[model samples]
Target: MFFMFIYYFLFSWNLAGVFGVDSVKSVSVTEGESVRLNSDLTEIQRDDEMTWKFNNIMIAKLKDSKSRFYEDNAEGRFRDRLKLNDQTGSLIITNTSTTDSGEYTVIGTSTDSTLNIFRLTVYANLSVPVISRDCSSSSSSSNCSLLCSAVNVGDVTLSWYKGNSLLSSISESNISISLSLPLEVEYQDKNSYSCVINNPIRNQITHLNITQLCHMCPDCFHCGSTEAVIRLALSVLVGVAAVAVMVYDIRSRSFQQKREQTSPSNNE
Candidate 1:
């Protein structure tokens, strides 16, 4: 019995591949947008019956030029969002969300059965990329540290760009989480920089303001670099030595004047 069932399944699949099965169509759409799955049929005859299924569960049907939608199916996930075209037996989904992403199949029956498949990917609206200074980084006076981030993102790419050229990039797939990318640039750099987050449907970008974010005071010193700290210490020591020398010279001049006055009095 098991062998017979396996043989029948394989035979059915092979026949489907040979005669009426079409290639799987790829469809991508952003959340809150509408998408249509084509049936590839020019017209539906009076005796034809077409059914739409999602994950192998029927959600819609077209028969005898009449259309029916099972909005309450799939745990009511398709409620008030499904539309069927009786003429071509196509299905349209309105106000789509990320949960709508899945495999959809359509089967038509009359004298011969026909099959059409679609792979749908519904992406959430991309959040704006946030650019901020990375204060925790060991940044030097000559270089600025920065981080670009996005939250609750999936199947997206985060990148840093210099003018129109790509600098660094990171990508994630199949998991929703926060994404962050780091960048470093010279404090006096005049070139334009930007951070971008993108999915298949849309992208978000944030431009970098080098002068504003990378500003450093003229007298500011950085302890992160040993060389810079050593230079600053040498400057402070030089200033203190010069002040001590001037004070010593003034005291010596005063002592000499007092000794000369005392000698003249003693001679008198």
Candidate 2:
């Protein structure tokens, strides 16, 4: 079982890496908010220059010995909107919009042909969600599941909550806007749960309350009722037996007393 778990983990991780980067990376912004993306060079010498490319065009250039590339390119719908800090090799795109959705590739030259690559993804706002669930109302209490669903959402997550308190959560995938949470449901007392569906793709929430309305009580009607009746009958029977025994003892004692007082042999 443990080995199977390990293999499952590795396989899932591999699958995530393979299918994870499917969506255009999203960044949330107000009307004029700035965001940052850091591109690091791994196994590369410090004397290398890093370059940020948007749509195959050089957007910003980094000086050698500086890890950052600053843009500050606020031209053509980006007037004072783009800021690229070349020293840290990070990009700060300001005043972002939906049209800003495109390929952003950062390339760092290594000694070998191994170019350290960083993809800068950008996204904004949220999408209307199409959602679903995995665990049903009839599911057992041991392992319950609920899935919130959507489309075209990259890097989203699903959080299960009972009221304000978080019950459980599951990470979202690239292809799917769905969130799956495997949880232990309380058999009786729990109810009215919701799944907050959110990630870099969109922000929305879905809910699954325990639809089966239950009055909180252990049922004592049938079996307990029978037991009470049986106990009452047994108590009545014991009372009658005790009364008969007491009456017999009293009658015997009285008869003995009468015989002693009226002493026929002694009188004769």
Q: What lDDT is reached at residue 100 by model 1?
A: 93
- The TM-score obtained by model 1 is 0.74
Top-lDDT candidate index: 1
User: After superposition, which runs of candidate 2 have C-alpha atoms over 4 Å from their true positions?
Assistant: 1-33, 41-49, 63-78, 108-115, 127-190, 193-202, 206-268
lDDT of 2 at 27: 43
Candidate-wise lDDT, in order: 0.85, 0.55
Q: Residue 267 lDDT in model 1?
A: 75
Model 1, 1-268: lDDT tens per residue?
9999999999988887655455677899999999999888899788899999998888998899888988788888999899988889999999999999999999886743546888999999989999877766768758888899987568899999999999999998756568999999988889999999999879999999987777543444541445667787999999999999999999999999889888967779
Candidates in order: C-alpha RMSD to true structure? 6.5, 17.5
**Please, what is the TM-score per model?**
0.74, 0.33
